[model samples]
Target chain A: MDPQKTGFDYSTFNPSYFQHLEQRIKDLDALGIQADLILFHPYDSWGFARMGQAMDKHYIQYIVARLASYKNIWWSLANEYDLMAQLGQKPLSAWDFIGKTVHQEDPSGHLLSIHNFYDPPVHKGTTKNWFDYTKPWITHLSIQSDNVFFVPKWLDDFQKPIIFDECRYEGNIEFGWGDNSAKGMVDSFYRIVLRGGYATHGETYIDKPNTTRPIWWAHGGILRGESQKRITYLKQLLATNGFNYVNPMAVQGPHWELAVGESPDKQHVFAYIGDNQPEFEIFDFLPKDNIYSAQVIDTWNMTSTKLNERIDKNHYFHIPRKPYQAILLTKIN
Target chain B: MDPQKTGFDYSTFNPSYFQHLEQRIKDLDALGIQADLILFHPYDSWGFARMGQAMDKHYIQYIVARLASYKNIWWSLANEYDLMAQLGQKPLSAWDFIGKTVHQEDPSGHLLSIHNFYDPPVHKGTTKNWFDYTKPWITHLSIQSDNVFFVPKWLDDFQKPIIFDECRYEGNIEFGWGDNSAKGMVDSFYRIVLRGGYATHGETYIDKPNTTRPIWWAHGGILRGESQKRITYLKQLLATNGFNYVNPMAVQGPHWELAVGESPDKQHVFAYIGDNQPEFEIFDFLPKDNIYSAQVIDTWNMTSTKLNERIDKNHYFHIPRKPYQAILLTKIN
Candidate 1:
């Protein structure tokens, strides 16, 4: 069981670890949740992160063989792969080998990705610090950035399911990565989802009196933040509308400041104006021939109100001039 | 005077225009205000923006000769000079010539700068869209960007007085540049000023019912936004504390998420936690020898409360988990 022992010693491998993972995956599957497992992380003081390439590949193979059969499994090679590489604990070649081993060994062909640590400098909607997500073994992008505005550009470049796995957390913790307010977290979630990407939520509220209790971000515990109900509302709205994917609207008017997304069929459009509270917005991009039933949604309050008057391309939809307001447009004919 | 006319004909020069400008400058001087005179702009239906290089130079000479005597005048060569250049109405050389002409004609040597339209791509804290403020004739950097986070870098690069003349406006207008909320405007001002720069406030609240009234941003009429009082509070706070310039703190702990600034003498520090609501923060970066009195400021509500306990390097400051809160530390011993 010693991590310092590099070569794969099957005789010494623990069966209880596999059993725990299998049970967890089964429970998550029953709950209709995807279990995004991190195979490596730099927050370890042990020698496991420093395991040689051969041992790493063997470990990946063993995990894939044991847990890849679960329908809910998503393979995250590392929490912060860049940090591991920077620390010289693992090289880029080792990550590639691990990814290839996981891909080859997994019969289920589950979602495979690696999370990044270096937040690439975004200039004119371009970045270079991402772990070449274009690689053959990488199935999708697992990003760690606060700039969800780049989701549209990433969708264009990668053409894959991009998940901002870590856009900080909703909490009152002291660290920068874990102290975002509930409203900020909800705003980020809507921004990411409406721009044709996905976001993962985490909570890091420090437990008072009994400060030793595990936080929801690191260890499973009670959800203390208020973003969960709003996120559920967003999910229900999208699912009820039968919208599987919504790309950013192509027009360049309100879309410059608003996160406006249209379904591939072009029948449903959702625009989230996060902070701006314009009194009325003209949707000149909507087809002139189509009539739309507009609904103003209060994202924070989890309420949707249907407008009495139908709207066309020529008309402006009057809004209540409030923050965290979203407008949903459904074509009537 | 016809805007289409090219050369500066003394016979046709309008004395009334000069008289009006003189009166306005005098009025502003009496009110202890600096009149930032924009000599050229692209929002023109007339041919004045299309004036030839000679006429542009002549106009600059005339304006500078007439207005330079006033102590409260700042020569902004053009509003969005880049837009004028992009329109092919004026070239870069023409701007350089105009800037040089203004510098030569203004014997009083008032503050001289040019605004830009191109929102530069900021990557790793570097931008290229700014007009060359390095030129000796330009006294300061007049910027038109919404990102006040880059003020520290801009201060480092330009080493000139930086004023974000248009970080959007405080209003509910339809335009993106004029639709920021009052809280957002106040946040931008603190972010700019804390990083050792300045910000100018503009309001674009559309007057309901009386829709034809001039907005404060373009044509000054009445200020309707709630940000003005908060900005005045900020100005009074800085002035009362005798803080001329406070650069962003060099250390990178809480400063990563918080806008923390320190006076050049290192005796005073101001930290603005814009959206984060951390319950407490540990300031280990402060000098261990200095004893300081700390005050928690509710920036939006315009209230300040002093903490009874003096803090040195070893203590953690307990804070209420709230948004738009700022902390001020002043040396007492």
Candidate 2:
């Protein structure tokens, strides 16, 4: 527990910490939430972040052995692992050893990944500072980039489920990584989800002087952002439509202006117009022979209106000329 | 002017074409506007784009001799010169020759430049396909990118005047490059101008079947978009304030989230909260020793409201918590 120690004393380790973690995992599992446990982080004043490789390996093995049996557990090896490496607390080989140890120790074969910090100078659009996601022990990619439009390329480059775990939170905090507006957050989610990836949400609203409420991103408390409900509506929309897999239609003509996606069977199509507010769009990208029922979705207001006119390749559909609008088309016959 | 011909006969070259260009240049000069004449383009079937080096040199010489006498004329050697190179109509060496020819032939020495087509695969953040802006003959940059956020980087890299001449037009056309909403266009202008660059505006709303109207971007017509007034307002604001040179405050703390800029003398500071609707921002970035008057500008509404409270490093300035709002601070003492 000393701040200057370089090794963990196993005999003096508290058992109550493991018990609290288990109880929290059980509670999250009951609520149908996956416990994405971050085992290492650089934002520490204690000596845990500076522990040498041997003690770090022992810590990872202990946690994986005790927690991997739960059905809803995702192992995040570290939050901002690159930052830790930059500070000389750990090296790339240390991360590799820790990852391999977790992969071998976990009996349940849970999802294992490492989150990264996006330092623009070193990690701008390139994976120069990222942990090797192509390693067999890593299950998926937990990225920290604000450019959600690049998700399609990342998905193509590494054939794994990509989760933008930190695309800048939805709040009014001063930091750049924590002060995106609600509309910005919703747009990022739609952009990523429509391109067959996932986005995580966080908030960092500074509380008033009298109120002692914790910021949602640092210490979990009551949710105070407007993006949560819209995100839930998006989730329900995807689940109801049975769109398990949607890929961006980059080769199609309209994809350049709109975030257009299509299901594998070519029956469901959706396009998210993020900031462009065109009054009307010609639906020439639709199939020529198939008839489709069109619906306009106001992502911000969480409203869906079915258009009276059925759409085909020849028809032009009029829109409300507003931002944060989407169109969903389902094959009718 | 024949579509199939590869050579130009000087005897048959129309004198009226030169006269018409001179008249147009005079008209634009009367309005205090610069005529950015594009000498060559690839969107042609007239074989002008594929003209050999000899004819190309002759054409450049003729235009520069006839047009460079006007003070308002800016020599854009070619529009989308990279696309011309990609299509094998002109290589880089040919463009260099054309630019050098224009530089040498123009007796009046008008501003000379070349515009580029942004093919994402080849020119994403890297200047691989861009014309060598470092050449002595080139005076400024005319870019075709929608990412106005990268203007600051381009300004640093090239150290030349940057103009996003084709950051997508404000319209409802079918083409991606010709269809951005009015709000989108205004936002692009603000982002670029705030970062000490310039942006050009265009409109491309498709007309009804019965009405035969030309697209503004293709053939000059009546103005229709809402962005023109806001851009004019921004121009007046800058002109009245005498901010001839403003640089981005990237090293400051709040610049990561807000588009903050300062005049070279640091007597004027402006921040554009483009899409972020923060309720209140702590004015800790301001100098503690100076007293300043603050104003909130509704960029889209073209309205400015002066605040009752003065600002310094100690005060927290509250905002309207809406999109497209800006804060302007002027040191009074």
Q: Pick the candidate with the highest TM-score.
A: 2
lDDT of 2 by residue, A54-128 (tens): 777778877887888899999999999988877877776778888889999998899999999885433554678
Local distance difference test, per candidate?
Answer: 0.79, 0.79
| lDDT tens digits, residue span B38-73, model 2 | 989978667788767888887887888888888999
Docking class of 2: acceptable
Task: Show pairs that collide, candidate 2.
Answer: none
Against the hidden reference, what TM-scores do the models get? 0.91, 0.93
lDDT value, residue B38 of candidate 1: 92
User: What lDDT tens digits, residue by residue, belong to model 1 across residues A1-333?
Assistant: 235564545335688978987998898889888999999988766668887877777777778878877889999999888777778777866778888888899988889999987432122223555688988989999988777776777788898889999887898776667788889999998888988899999888884423687677667757878998899999998888867877776324333447778887888989888887567667776776989998999999999999887877776656788899898989999
Considering only N, C-alpha and C atoms within 3 Å, which residue pairs clash in candidate 1?
none
Q: Scored by Cα lDDT, where does model 1 land?
A: 0.79
- Distance from true position, residue B147, model 2, in Å? 1.0
* Fnat per model, in the order shown: 0.38, 0.37
